[model samples]
Target: MGRWRPPAEKKSKYITATGYKRMNDELKYLWKVKRPEVTQAVKEAAAQGDRSENAEYIYGKKQLREIDRRVRYLSKRLDDITVVDRIPDDQGTVFFGAWVTIADEEDNEQRYRIVGPDEIEASGQLISVDSPLARQLLKKQVGDEVYLQKPDGSEIWYEVIAIEYEPY
Candidate 1:
C-alpha cells in the first residue's frame, strides 16, 4: 500500500476576539515558558549518560516534540486568523460568536456557542463555526426551521429559539 493520503481541506479563518486572545496567550506560554522549561529538562536528562537506556531522556524528548508541534500550529493559525470582535448588526439572527438556543422536533432544547475552531473546548458547549450545525444556523432568525442532513444519511430538524452575542 502507498504511504500517502490527501491533504485536508482548509478551514475558515474567522475567529472571535476572545478565541484569538486565548490562542495568542497559549502560543506565548508555550514558546516563552513551557519550551524553556522542557528544553532545560531535556538538557539535564541528556547529561545522564547513554540516552538509549535513559527513561528521562526519552520522555523529555517526546514531551518536547509535542509542545513544539503545538507551538508551530498556533503560530501559523494566529497569522491567518481574522478576529471578529464586534457583534453582528442583526441580534435577532445567528452569526459568528452568537450564543444560540435551538429546539429539536421533540421540543428538547439545546444551547451552543458558535466560535472559532481553536476555541473549542471539551468542557464547553462551543461549536466550530465551520461545523454543519453552525453553518446552517448562520444568518438564520428565531422561529426559523432548519433541516440538517447528517453524514449518516439521516436528517434532523431544529427551530431557532433564541440568539444573542454576549461577552464571555
Candidate 2:
C-alpha cells in the first residue's frame, strides 16, 4: 500500500469557535464511542462461526479495520492541525472565510467561500484556501481579473465582483 500520509498543509486561520468545537466533538465520538462499538461488534461476529466462509465475520472485520483506520488518522491529523479561529485582518480582499462573488467573462456569476480543507463543502462552492483558484484570488480586490489553470489545456478568468465576511 502507498504511504498513509503526506506532509501536513498549513490550515486557514478562519474557523469559528463553534467549528473548532464541532471538529473536536467528532474526534472524541469516534475514539470513545464508535471505536468501542465497532470492536465489540467484530468480536461478536467472529465468535459466531468459522473465519473462512462467514460473511458476517468478514464484514465485521472490515468495519473494525475502517474504524481503527479513521481513529489513527484523526489522532495524527488533530495533532498537526492548528485550528484557525482568528479572522484575517484584510476584509476588502478575498481572504480565508470570505464569501466572494465573481463574474466570468461570459457574465456568469458564482459565489464561493474560501475555507479550510477539512470544513469545505463542494455543494456550497466552499473551496479550500490552498486551492489554485483561491491562491490566485488571495489579495485581489473588486474588478481585478484572476485566472486559474485547468486540466483541460485552457484557463478560466473571473473578475472579482464582491467580497464580504460580515453577517449574510
Candidate 3:
C-alpha cells in the first residue's frame, strides 16, 4: 500500500501584535526554562545507569523530544509571521484582527475574532484567517450576506452584523 499524501496548503502570514507577543513568549519560556529543566532531568536519569531498564530515562527522553519539536515549530513560525498592528482605514469592513458578529438564517448571532492560526485558543471564539468561513467573511461589510458551501455540499448563509477592531 502506498503512503503518499498531498502537501498542506500554506497558511496566511498575518498575526496580531498580541498573538505575535504570545508566540514569542512561549518560545522564550520553552528555550530558557523548560528545555533546561528537561535536559537536567534527562541527564540525571542517564547517570543512574542501566538505561534499558530505566523508566525515568525513557520518559525524560520522550518529554525532551516533544519540547524540542515545539521549540522548532515556534521558531520557524515566528520567522514567517508578519505582525499586523495597524487598523484598516475602512473599519466597517471585515479584515484581519476584526471582531465580527454574524447572524445566521435563524437569527442566531455568533461572535468571532479573526486571528492568526497560532493565536487560536481553546476558550476563545477565534477563527483562523485560512478557514473557509473566515475567507468568506474577509473584506465583507456589515449587512453583507455570506454564503458558504459546506464540505457536505450544503450552502449556509450568514449576514454580517457588526465589526470592531481594538487598538493594539
Candidate 4:
C-alpha cells in the first residue's frame, strides 16, 4: 500500500480564552527560551569538531527541527482560531465552555466541560466540541435526554442534570 494518506478533517476554530493563552504561552516559551538553549548547545557541540560522530550535535539539530515545526503549527493555528471569552446569554443551556453534569439510566453521574479541540486535555473532564457527546449536548438544557452511539455500536442515554459556566 502507498504511504500517502488523506488529509485530516478540519477541526472547529473556536477556542476558550484560557486555551488560547495556554497555546500562546507555549509558543513563546519554545521560541524564546527552549530554542535559544538548544541552539547554544548545538553551537558548542559543533565547536568540538568531528560532527559526524557528535551525538550532542545530531540530537540538538533534531530537537531544533521539532521545535520549529511546533512553532509553525501554533502560529498558524492561533491566527485561525476564535477565542470565546464571553459566556453565552443562555446559561441554562449547554454551549462551548459550559460545565455539564449528566446522569445515566443507572444513576451514574459524570461531569464534562465542552471545549475546543485544542483544549481537550488528558483529564477526562474535558470533551472536544467536535466530539459525538458534545454535539449531542449542544443547546440542551437541564432535564433533557441525550443519546450517544458508541463506536462499538452500543447506544447510551444521559440526562442533563446541571449546566454551569464558571469553573469549579
Question: TM-score winner among the candidates?
Answer: 4
Q: Which stretches of candidate 4 lie over 4 Å from their true place?
A: 1-3
Q: Write down the TM-score of every candidate.
A: 0.92, 0.80, 0.94, 0.96
* Native-to-model Cα distance after best TM-score fit, residue 16 in candidate 3, in Å: 0.7
Say which candidate scores most in lDDT. Answer: 4
How do the candidates rank by lDDT, highest first? 4, 3, 1, 2
Over the stretch 1-168, how does candidate 3's per-residue lDDT look in tens digits? Answer: 999999977888999999999889999999999989989998999999999989999999998899999999999999998999999999999999999999999999999999988788887689999888899999999999999998899999999999999998
Compare candidates 2 and 3 on lDDT and give the better one.
3
Structural RMSD, model 3: 1.7
Model 1 Cα shift for residue 61 (angstroms):
1.4
Full-model lDDT for every candidate: 0.91, 0.78, 0.93, 0.96
Instruction: Kindly list the per-residue Cα lDDT of model 4 for residues 1-168, writing each as its tens digit.
Output: 889989998999999999999999999999999999999999999999999999999999999999999999999999999999998888999999999999999999999999999999888999999999999999999999999888899999999999999742
Which should have the higher TM-score, number 1 or number 4? 4
Clashing residue pairs for model 2? none
CA lDDT, candidate 3, residue 95? 95
How many backbone collisions does model 3 have? Answer: 0
* TM-score leaderboard ranking: 4, 3, 1, 2
Model 1 lDDT, full chain set: 0.91
Off by over 4 Å in 3: 1-5
Q: Name the lDDT of candidate 2.
A: 0.78
Residue-level lDDT tens digits of model 1 in 1-168: 997989987888988888888899999999999989989998999998999999998999999999999999999999998998997777998989999999998999999999988788997699999888999999999999999998899999999999988864
